[model samples]
Target: MLNIADTLHGWCRAARPFALATVVGTRGSAPLPVGTSVAVDEDGTAVGSISGGCVEGAVYELCRQVLHDRGAPQRAWFGYSDDDAFAVGLTCGGELDVLVQRVDPGTQPHLAAALDETVQGGPAAVAQVVDGPDELLGRTLCVLGDTDSAHGTLDGGPADRVVAAQAGALLRAGRTARVEVGGDADTCPERLSVLVHVHASRPRMLIFGAVDFAAALSQAGSFLGYRVTVCDARPVFATEARFPYADEVVVDWPHRYLERTEVDARTAVCVLTHDAKFDIPLLRLALGLPVGYVGAMGSRRTHDERLRLLTEAGVTEERLARLRSPIGLDLGARTPEETAISITAEIVAHTNRGTGLPLSHLSGPIHRDRALVS
Candidate 1:
């Protein structure tokens, strides 16, 4: 899916009136998770995808209606059934609750600034009044920067203050949630539901090799919302021109660079440097880190040899067990690009605690819990 905030920022800068459709809730096996959005302009131009091509046409029509009527923020539902699947289709056999609203820079000034922050890869959150009174509908509260400072018209009032505090908490947690404000007999009897969408900085993907496969993996990692860094000891190979998609290029030893760099639970470390001089030391340190993944690329024989070397170096067996020796899933990949896909697929599956099984074979919900480690 395209970056909705970046696209919205571009359209807003061009002064194009548009309607933003966001999936605030879902049930069963919805293709996309909550917070996914698609923006449709008056000219019928659209960007982003909320359902992976499952219900764009119907959502587009809703956008047209919203723009035509200059309506209040409206919530619409689309379900997957044999009867309606052929009409307003969702092949995934799931249901979607979408909120569509007409947006303009003049009306949604805070949203415009939030979009700018998101486009610049800064952390921010946008809280929208999805279900509320007519005056509160479409009202937004945006919290920008790490300090959790609030910016928007949705402040000052008691209920609005509650929504802003909830949004800031969700932003700090780096997770999206629906918060209910008011509904108190003493304060306000009517309840309002605010959908808080957290926009954190992209996760980091540290590729330890600047080889032919690194180029492909860098592109794939960037597409998967990772700020990729291609690191190598050879300055000639670790040039920005080689891996244009990488956010940074570091000409340093793999293990040394990783030791000093900041890595969190969301970070992924892929040690594609197959050489023992590079892989052994790097894997030893990586296996002990708190990062999400640690994988080394090599054949079985090379893996065995590397393991022996690591064991002899006094690395614990439990730490050794953390390494994904063959690197990627067993996809029979031959080309560098295909190998990159296999590696990234494994990383994603590992990050989500998935079994790397095909969707057709899975019996449970296709979408996993969207929350990351706090």
Candidate 2:
């Protein structure tokens, strides 16, 4: 998918006018998640998507009208269940509230800068307050770098900081939140409401093995919107030709390689180097970190042997349990490609804590429609 933020930057640099539509809230089976953005240039060409094929046509038409009329920024909500919902609603039968703003150079430079930085950094989240009629209009914050400083102010003071802090935490968790400012000594919203758009680009997947399965897994991970890396001590097998889909091919020992890098709660590491010579040292290194997901691939007997070896190597039960050996959900996948799908599916399941059940069997709302990035 084209990076909407980059496209917006180009428009900004060219002094061309454009409208940005961001999904701010959702109540039902919305097609896109909060923070999903769509930027429409003067020509009506767009980048990014807010809903499926359901709402883009309407949003684009509205954007054109807004640009032509020089209209003020406003928030619009589309509910799927409305009688005429199909006319300008989410086809998924959900409701999504979008913040449509007309941006120019003087509008929110910090917001543009943050978006550009995030686009270059791959995928990150940007939070902005489009509402709070009393507080801030068009004020924004970028949250990927661990701190939440504003592009502008809803109202500066301890109250803003408190809200910013809370927004940053939610952003890191890849979620959006609507906050109300209470009565504080300095200033308060007095029942003011601000819509925070927190966008989480994608997760990073590091695979420590350049075997056949690793190549397939990299391809599979890419389909799930993961930045995949394949590393192996053997340069021959780790060659780019073997795994063209991997974003990075590293010729390095697993343990030494991970030591120099930072892995956080959003990172996933897969150890497919089944040999104890490589597996044990790598597991030792990975177990000490706070990575979101860590898994090792092997057959049942091999997994058992690895566990025994880890015990012999002084690995504790607490740390050992963290390892997802035999590395995938029980899909009984037999081929490398199928196995990769199972592994990637497990990653999604773990990230969202989703029940791996067929949708036809479920009764409640579909949690959220993840952007189908490939």
Candidate 3:
């Protein structure tokens, strides 16, 4: 799928066929999220991972079978089996369903073009049938950004249009989801049931400072799969050479830039400019937004003063409570790189609803089950 688009695009350009294995469903402690894919060339070259190293060997062989068989797409289930130790399964006591589909560049040119577009940093979503009729297996429908027109088809009927609309919604939210379709004439023409996987664009991370800490945080954000933007009013400080990892470097007032930028529940905003002039107006605007994480960099006294100023400036305590004043977790970080880790860790914990407690003190599933199998 989209996760391995770069590798597949290379094969597509060379007219080499490949078998794509995508993890479409999960249960228990699935290591990889759904939409994670592995693509194998005709000669057994593989790109990407499904269950880390747990079931990759088996999946590689399955890829070869799918390419040669080239029949309907095949779905393989992997999970722990106490019945037989020799059986190929996950050791993490998790279950995953992988859908293997063969793609020929000459036959599926539209799909190849879609991969090309995605690899070139275009905004879109591709809904592929992972659970459905055998005839519809491996079928895909791509919904380009803000476009009513779609690139491919599922049944070349009403079902295709329905799935395209669903994919477009999830695409705007930057989410990968399992979409169900098919019913009576009110929905689909037939009672054929189908499930599709919709992969979306990356979330945005806006760093409202061009300070040394902002430079390091941009790198960490990019590594965590966020499209990072470093912004500042000073053009000299917000140059691309300073924050090479950032997707964008904007020279604009923090508050003004934030007002003009688009944000969502997936967006993260970090304010590293501790100066009151920059902090007050910016934090006032940021705290009221629907962004996932909002953090401000400052000392204890500075945090108190900033909060008082925000409260006087008409920011409610409820909105102020949403801000992570003083930024970062208490990791005793002295350097910018270490501070960046602390800040990003807090962001992940906030997004996942995780307690900032040590793992040794908590006795339960390492990962929340709800976080998986989505």
Estimated TM-score per prediction? 0.76, 0.82, 0.85
Q: Pairing residues by index, what is the TM-score of model 1?
A: 0.76
157-182 in candidate 1: lDDT tens per residue? 66656666777777665667777777
Q: Any idea what lDDT model 1 has?
A: 0.83
Clash statistics: count for each candidate: 0, 1, 0
Best by TM-score: 3
- Distance from true position, residue 337, model 2, in Å? 1.2
The list of candidate 1 runs beyond 4 A from truth reads: 1-3, 10-18, 38-72, 81-86, 89-91, 102-104, 131-137, 153-194, 222-225, 235-247, 275-277, 299-321, 369-374
lDDT of 2 by residue, 191-272 (tens): 3455555556567799998888998999998888788889999988889899999988999998888999767777899999
Instruction: Please give the distance, in angstroms, between residue 80's alpha carbon in candidate 1 and its true position after superposition.
Output: 2.7
TM-score ranking from best candidate downward: 3, 2, 1
Residue 78 lDDT, candidate 3, scale 0-100: 93
* Residue pairs that clash (backbone atoms under 3 angstroms), model 3: none
Kindly list the per-residue Cα lDDT of model 3 for residues 1-374, writing each as its tens digit. 78788898899999998899998878877888878899999898999999888888899999999898877688899989776523578888888988898988887676777777788777667777776667887787777766646787888888877887777777776767777778667556544433334445678999988999999999999999999999999998999999999999999999999999999988999999998899899999999888889999999999999989999999998998999979999899999999999999999998878887899998766666333112
